[model samples]
Target chain A: MNKTINPLSRQIFIMAFSLLMVYPVLWWLGASLKSNAEMSSPNIFSKNPVWSNYIDGWFAVPNYSFTHFYLNTFTLIGGVLFTTIISCSLAAFAFARLDFPLRKFWFAILLVTLMLPGQVLTVPQYVLYNWFGWINTYLPFYVPHALGSGAGGSFFIFMLVQFMRGIPKELDDSARMDGCSWFRIYWYIMMPLTKPALVTVGIFCFLWNWDDFFGQLLYINSVDKYTINLALKLFIDTQSAMPWGQMLAMSLLSVVPAVIIFFFAQKHFVEGISAGALKG
Target chain B: MNSDITSSSTTIALSRKPKRWESPLAGYLFLMPWIVGILVLVAYPMVMSFYYSLTNYTILDTPEWVGFQNYSEILFEDDTFRQSLKVTLLFVLFAVPFKLLFALVVAMLLNKEIRGLSFYRTMIYFPSLIGGSIAISILWKNIFGKEGFINQLIGIFGFEGKSWINSPDTALATLILLVVWQFGSSMVIFLAGLKQIPLDLYEAASVDGADWFVKFRKITLPMLSPIILFNLVMQTITAFQMFTQAFIITKGGPINSTYVYVMYLYELGFARFQMGYASALAWILLLIIAIATALVFLSSRQWVFYENEGGK
Candidate 1:
């Protein structure tokens, strides 16, 4: 039933919604370029844009540079992506392919962990980290990702397992017929075929680690060791006047890498999130 | 090549049942990293937290056995605890339904064949990716602050606006707005679910002379119920655990009006160094979420429709 609605009205509706969605981002970009004096002015949009705020905010924090924060965040993301890919892929392969004793029980245990809020374990985890001398180090930041420890990582593993289940058992049977060991079958056959799922998992791990604020705040105390998100918090805290321009400039800069990653990995992001939801 | 293949198969046959730990060892090896990580990081800490919840532990000293004192105090004596609970509940109540509704509406709109669909989807989904960061919280504070962009826009309508981030009445509302703005992720999931719904169902309804509203109610709503449940559970959990926005924008400010439960727990554990009490609060939160989720699952039997069940 092609009920002809007015194209003009629908376009207007789309435009209005788009503008409403885009307005905050535009305002943020504008505010990030405005000086403190201009920020205090009645008209936020009318202010002369000072492009140097980005440079100034870059150097504003003492001893701990934005570059350092960027590096730290990148390392965290890299570490997480690397470890999550390895561990989740391996575990997913085992769960999807191997017949083992009490496999369902173990899978059920993993599922139970997903429901338990991370906050419930924060204090004890902090103490454990402190006890292990992992506090103030990047170990606490990246170790969980490496180990498939969080809900995101475990959920990703579960997702990969489901996708792997869809792969034909004939491939495994053929590989076995060709005298390939189980390990070789998983490594050579399954791993390469599951690249899309891996990419999805990798993008998620990277984005999650990059944007993680609470974990960084809890684990990393020193400014020099701070992730980008933690540095952004520090930037907000130390500004005498609301350094709106510099804050915006830094925030915009901070979001650029994630946005770039998101754009490049958009397909995986969509597929992974949807698959995860559907499976759940 | 045949001799090589024969030798490999013979080798596999030779190694198949050599020992109890031979074949499954590789499987266990593959899963070792995650298993060990869970034991050290997840399981151990969880047990420790449960133990700590029954004690009077501070960061500076060893935990002393207190046996339900912390839980009792939080339930009865602490006013801020009560306030935080009320604020968090209010925030969840206000945010979750609106978020789901907004997600469903946007998903419906985007489900149509449109020009620049990818671009529109990107624009919407980008916020959810960005909103999880501290930068978004900073942006939120600036936008909602007195003499900020929101006020500037309000002035265009000849209305003077108060400092939203600093006012008790408006602080929580601003946080709610922030939550609402990040509806993109859920909307994408909903869109995916919408795609799975066969268009022929809608066509059949239209052939029966069903109105748009009637078709939407009878067809779309029932088909979308499972996705709705998924979104609801996830969004509810997120809403309850909201921290970054409140932390950056108001710091649970203006007479603890926006003081969310998690923020209070953070303050108790980190700021005040009350580890035991904080652990207790965490467990309480876990209980609350689990009960709420269980309740939803129980109610889903009544309302949530699975397509394979033939709408039973």
Candidate 2:
């Protein structure tokens, strides 16, 4: 029920909290553009903006090229998105439609993996990767995505399965009656109908792989092989004594791609994350 | 004429008696990639980790089976392990409730019909998207450092502020604040849940002259129980596995006061090359989380409401 309180006061409260949330980000952007001297000054907001820090930060380190880092991150995110979509969709189809023996058991096992912490697996995974000579290579970063190894892949499979279950079984039966193979029904009908789930999975996989830090740190050893997160870490290490302006500049720059992608895929991201919870 | 007759008869037979394994075989083929991947990447590693937990293996050396010695040592002889457990439990205990409450309140506010609702929602969710990033962690370190922005702000209020990141007393607390600030993801989920709730329930309560607080307690909280449980379980898991912030911001320093279990496991596995011991720690963490989750599920019958159950 609507309260007896003044609508004006409610509006004011909302506006104030909104500003509280937005101000830090705006301040971060402002600080990032200011000169080093200005950043250390008493007045944080009054500083004169200097955009050169972004340029200089980009070119600061040798062999730590921001371009290479971007390419590596792009490859990682792309591989994750592609592999997650293909593998999870196929598996989700199996769980959602094609009834086979012991299906419930296998699905339960898959759900169990979702609860296991990444740290519990990290040690053994490191040893295994080293044994396979996969360390210091992109294989460590991308292979899991391709293989549906991490939580993202499992969550995607679960999400897609939930959405797929909502599709009418009569469509599959009709296709079967028309002499269409199971594969044909899945590829032609089910896949197209589940585009929303695919988009949701794709956006999440992109954001997750792009922001992954621990995985990158463990796998990529050389400076030249650094992803954006690793590069940012190295930047911090070398410029520990530098002004906050340059560091904040680089940090803000590092987050721009994620923010941009989030805005572009905002609808799908929210739907994907909340759908399972809502259904449950 | 004879060949055409034979082909027609074969087609009739094929339609009459389909291959028993055909459909399932196709399904298996479709599932092959994920199945193989899970076997090699997930299942194999899990089994191997169980094996490693029983051994005294370093990364460079072959493992020697030692039965339950590693588990016993960790359980009985390790002080650092106990301390890590304490720190982690403290974190989950303090952070989860406050995060859930803050998220719920903000979500309720946003659920109201307001101008620019999407913008407000977007603004709130920004922190969670950037929450675990190294850049944000670094920003936190700077903001909480001595002579940093937070202290400078405190100075205006005539309050002396300590070096939050460096001080053992405040390091973990600062991280908790950081986590609470990033309640955006849970907030979004809560908002979605709030939208699903029928307005008629509140209307009915108001018809009976129920007050706001009474309606909220009787209706809103109960209806939202499932979503609350979802948030609680997920947040609890994430909190236990917390690594990035403690690693980058505090470095688990100032006498290991901020040394979270996962961070210590990382040091053992990668930095110190103590794979066997790290695997033991990992298993312990898994056990802790599993037990905690089990406890939640066990208690859920008391608080969590399922609408379908009333029909049954």
Candidate 3:
């Protein structure tokens, strides 16, 4: 009975601590559904929840609903994922499966780049993009992916390389024996087998791109061109009235897509993170 | 350490010495995108930015090289430069330690074999997923505003709570709290590290009737030191580069208390059109980060445990 007391209290502590950790998120949701008058009440639930806040906040800004922003965000994310997965897999195939010139040298460069912080690249990348007239457009984000430098896409490539190396070479050997070209093997055999790693990379790319506030804020300027993250900021920075309820409502809703994705892909997301940050 | 990353990741089979007909063309095609991206996006800017850092070019005109003038000015003349550095350093000092401490603690808690583990882990990690979004910053503003939930809660006890994110005294602390709240990534890593610690060590400790604290001190911590160092270096670098929350929440004011280094760089590069000056600032930041990283690496040799070296 005395021994049970220790484990019992420990379990209780974990439970209570878990609630404390999650209360802010729940409160965020509840606040989104609360009236302005009821905001200062401090209780998470309102006497009468306002479902209208979502509607009101969705269309808070003029001439454009949050629908446009959500679409824009998805377009950016979809493009990034498509390019990142395709290009990273391509590069990973080269490093992992194929023998090439300067393979070790280039691989070394990628490894060295792992330590170079993104902030160092910001100023010059901005200047170069500006020279190419890419600012205030999605091209700044898109072109990088096509070139295979889409934010941390190189890290994605490195991770995919690691994942690919783990796959049995016998599969590649047999596939080659069956007269499969390198590209075909990479596409059919290697890619299919790397689904878990690809999922990890894809989820992280989505989550990171979704919440990439600074990068988005730097390039995107026109209101019509704004993503959900930029739009939420627009609601506040441009407002004199400062619609706290509407802003909070929109803010809460803005996080849903990312939060939902994360909740679903938590395992892959965590795995991807470790593969990139730790194993490297 | 330089050898650490490449040694593990780059060890691929080189046994297939292909025929001359099996040309390197296809592999180059596979790698072309990254090569092009690196040359165009990464390498070009890195080199040009170094030149830009030496010049006095506003975006309006061609840059004129001024031979280390901008660097010297920042080191000697710039007041905001100094202030922002101070703010950013303080941020790194306080936020990184506290955030890592929470991560280690929470990681230790969840390390125990318990039921419903995933549920707790998910809930704790959820904050970090959305924590960097503008939406979360806006939520933080609401919660810390004068008439926000916090003040309202304290109102019942007849205690006045100041606007936390608005007051210079507490604004940085508010940002630190937010960083600490987003300890999910570090927590996840720490959890992984804890799992890697040999179960036999714990079994042996218990067999000897060693208490939890003593065992954790002698066994767990020493084993986890490498991971701890990694987190410390990574978190410190991240804390230095922190911008979004400060940019949105404070916009670097209530008297520039939150005017962090990145904010200053953004202002110099974009708002003031002093791209040349901003480039110099960015380089200095890189130098500082390099020094800090080196210091951490140097210090690591003393305390960081490597099992290959028989740390025990």
Candidate 4:
């Protein structure tokens, strides 16, 4: 029954379908180089490309450039990455290894939070953050992640916990016999061994926090503090007849970091996702 | 001196007393941040959110208590709420199944022992990595705009195309298409699950002269049900909370055809500063998600095959 389509035909079919899947993205690349006049034309790319789109769009936002937004984004991502790695790995280690009171209960809660919609907490969390005077600052972003409750923070911990469980218990016992403390075992032994999972968590933390437009839009209101996402959204709101070519140019730039990371660390991402699904 | 040191170490080992790190307090110590997080960030806010739902708390004034008023008005009187709910439900219903179906089909095709497998996987999965950014949403808007690439392409074929995003009939469809476009991550998960199914099972089926469809039905589907359930729940919850594309691409526009639940909630809470009403909406959203998830789980017992449960 399967021989209806030979292997050679199947390969051709997959190749064609893959091209169709990424067709829009390819168009996006070509369109970003097109002059505004060329936008309506059916040609993917213009002969004389307008390179000014990226340069102009970079400084299009008044008083603040893309540089400022990129800085804000990197700063936010850096802090979130650090905090998520430290906090989530600790929580995962504790859950996976430690025998504490109510461990199962808390672990179950972590699993529940993995599926809970973030919208439920938005209104009151806004109020709470407002009360703390954190509405216009990055503290709201930082504090939750530091405490292992940010977006996908629970899932990160859950993933790490699954990874840590696969590690033999004897390693911990051997370290303990050498007068190593639990913290030491986690820091010295478990962290190094769970490097793959930690890298996965870091990559996810960076990507999710970067793409979190809603949270950034809600919190960082001022121009100077705007992230790349907020800046992009602002670019649209401010421009009545938006420079399509310029807008496309900047949008392409905006996704570059994520694309680069995905390509560079593609293996970890695939493994991380597979592990999270199968093991969890 | 060496013998003296050895004897002391032996004594220490013989005692085998629990180290300070072995104590239960260490566990709490490790969990302290998350504990504080759940209380301050999750638990307290959830309770306060419920309270705010019952009040007339616009952020400007002190929260005036009007118990159940917000809930009553929303449930009984709101048209936009119902519209948003319908749009959201339709979006989820269409998007999740189509995305999963595409993902599974592609996964099956790529599961073969083919050359350039990684290349195909990478190209297909690339979209999902950056799909959620505002940039992609902006790109989507232009792609479906009046003079966008799609319309232009169709025009060349003598098939007239309208501005898809600006039409009420097609606005939500474009959004669903956007969601369906990023089926890469699900495809990856499905691919992994596909690999885990024992080759021997397929080989045995072949020996019995079973066709591809029979092998797939009796072997692949049962083994992969759990992953299917996982993808279903994740994608459903995600589809329900979809805000960025609707907010940016369509702005919930063309007569609110794309106004999702969260967009409505966002308008009420953030734009109009109706924290109380928005909180009510938020609670209902939570309820909807919970029921939906529970329903999926309940339904899964009938379809999802658990190996540990001793194969039905």
Best by DockQ: 4
Where does model 2 exceed 4 Å of error?
Answer: A1-5, A40-42, B1-22
lDDT of each: 0.85, 0.83, 0.86, 0.92
Q: lDDT, candidate 4, residue A170?
A: 99
Candidate 2: docking tier: acceptable
Better of 1 and 2 by lDDT: 1
CA shift of B290, model 4, Å? 1.3
Off by over 4 Å in 1: A1-7, A40-47, B1-23
Interface Cα RMSD, each model: 2.4, 2.0, 2.8, 1.5
TM-scores for all candidates: the values are: 0.94, 0.93, 0.94, 0.96
Cα lDDT for residue A22, candidate 3: 81
lDDT of 4 by residue, B165-244 (tens): 99999999999999999999999999999999999999998888888889889999999999999999999999999999
Q: Model 4, residue A259: what's the lDDT?
A: 88
- Model 4 DockQ, alpha carbons vs. true complex: 0.62
The alpha-carbon RMSD values of the candidates against the true structure, listed in the order shown, are 5.7, 5.6, 5.8, 5.6
Top TM-score: which candidate number?
A: 4
- Give the CAPRI class of candidate 4: medium
| Decoy 2 TM-score against native | 0.93
